[model samples]
Target: MNLKEIKLAPFIKLIFIIAIIAYVVLNTDIMGFVSKGISPVLTAFIIAYILDYVVRFFELKMKVPRSLSILISILLFLLILTTIGLFIVPRVVGAVSSLIKAIGNFEFDINALSQLDFDNFYLNEIQQAIVDTVTPLIQKLTNATGTAVLIVVNEVQKITSGLISLVISFAISIYMLGEKRDLLARIKRTLFAYLSDQTANQVLYASRMANKIFKAFFLGKLLDSTIIGVLAYLVFTIFNFEYALLIALIIGLTNMIPYFGPFIGAVPAAVITLIANPSSPIDVVWILICILAIQQLDSLVIGPFILGDSVGVSAFWIIVAVTVGGATFGIVGMFMGVPVLVLLKTLIEEDVEKRLAFQGYEGFQSNDIKNKKSRK
Candidate 1:
């Protein structure tokens, strides 16, 4: 049968077959030759790669050359890195160290708490047992936390696999950016050469969807976190909450975890404040309430203003992504899980819409719909 005569289902099966073949090749020997050491160089270049589009934007539209644009990109990249290194890093390190010190003094903090009596407090036998079990652990938390962090750092050093993987990832991203266009065009031609034009376009469209998801996710995350952090710091400092800078920073960063990050970040911050001032439990509680209010504002108010309806992944998918990421990569996995879901969701949506329109559905111009509406 002629290529166009082949049934769509069989064609899809063939594409999956090709994808499996490609995956195996990438998994086996083909990927082995593409990477080496100097991961930091690769890291810088990945930073450069993201900025390259901006560079190219200025170059083509603003009447500049590639070299000058690249230079501008490089300078901006370094300035950003330097700014973070000099300004942000110190504060981060100090906050971490302070938290550790507080942990080291945990027993003292809790013991101080136990020196009080509660009026009209009622507890069942089960409640009393639970409290007894938890109290000692809470007492030991300060030491345990510092010790746990030390153990983790040691394990990271012991594991030779992580460092190697990190290096390879950076190297791949670097080379990919440097030769992106030539490689992209070659891949496009190769995919289109064998496959139907429609199938090739689907692959291209999926890739674009994935890229858009990544951009929306990462940029949105950075923006949301920054605003929350700045607001938290300003509010906390005004109220003179203990560990304001540290707690605000932590809350701001972790707030991006969605639904759960705020709680995770806030609990620790509140605990630290409680440890620092067990006498002022009421004050600590009030501060926590304030922090929660800030989070609510961020989620409902500022968040919508910035992010809009960009990522349309639902709540159920979010839970699934978090579960999978935490299962595989622990905290880091959990942190990135939602973004993965967002990308996958976008890709799925694009594919489904394409298939619907392929057989001819009215008003199914998914790509141009947004542009047209905006123009109108």
Candidate 2:
């Protein structure tokens, strides 16, 4: 090759490499492939991570043996899982059966509407418009009942697979936890072997921050959801709502999704009530009231207390994260999106502060401003 052609070869090769990577990412199921490949490792990491906290509490505070601590933690975890299963499974099955039986049989009747006399022309016109809207909405709801039932069944099937995966993951995690110190030492050695001290420290710092954010967010959410779920159960029992256990479980679980969680949980309960007791539309109204009351308490009181500054993202960004995460990874994505956003926000803020400090800027960091105000 000529001198100029030889000089351009590296640039051409770099472009080709970039094009190939982009094409593979765009055209292939790269995410699915990666998820399938790393799922076991990821699952193990999560289990070990959670168990570490419990194991540490036992070993450190309770002065239990490390091995004994691990065993205790696992047993406690299993006990909680079993208790929840016993409480939730039977009710969920019964609710599903009732829903299936009630579907396709539900009818909408507003016969009393015809007897209403609206003397004002504008009021009459508005009444007619509302009736017209309700007619089609009811028809659509009727048609969707079967689909809803199938969706619940499909969700259960996913749960079954998830449980199997969980078992395998926990098995791996037990081993990891048993070898925690060795594993951590090995990981640190590997990082330092290949990465410079500064880079290794940066990576470790980022990982620690991410872990802290995730743990805090998840624990807070779990407590919040549990409280909301209990409140829902109490309300349903007080009001004599059908499928109380099943509906309350739905509310509790979906409450993990954030922003849309309450409404999402409410929809199924409302739909089932409407279908099973067409004559008692007030029950649906009461259910809505219960949801609103619990959510208000959560948002104004419990949520703020438990999860304050955990996500760091504003409500709008949280909504966007939930939407994108749900679209990309379904329920798991929606659950994780907020904490991931928090980690990213923290990293960005720190990077910005570092850059500002490097540029000889003062009092630019958020903490600095807050400190100044507190001093005043």
What is candidate 1's lDDT per residue for 25-127, written digit by digit as tens? Answer: 4466654554334444556455655776667777899988766776676677668778976987778767767766767665433344444455435634545
Candidate 2 per-residue lDDT over residues 1-376, each given as its tens digit: 2222223354357546864774565357995687676798889988788878899999999999999999999999899889868977777788878777776677767656645788988987888887887777788877876787889888888997898888888899999999999988999999999999998998899889988899888988988999989888998989888878878888999998899898888898787778778888888998898889989999999998888767766778789879976776578778977887777667765765665666665345455333211331
Reference-based lDDT, residue 186, model 2: 93
Q: Cα lDDT of model 1 overall?
A: 0.70
Cα lDDT for residue 367, candidate 1: 65
Which pairs in model 2 have colliding backbones? none
Model 2's alpha-carbon lDDT is: 0.81
Using all chains and alpha carbons, the TM-scores for the candidates as numbered come to 0.70, 0.81
Model 1 ranges with Cα > 4 A deviation: 1-49, 56-66, 108-130, 145-180, 193-198, 349-376
Model 2 spans with C-alpha error above 4 angstroms? 1-37, 110-133, 144-163, 327-329, 365-376
For TM-score, the strongest prediction is: 2
Q: How close to the true structure is residue 132 of candidate 1, measured as C-alpha lDDT?
A: 72
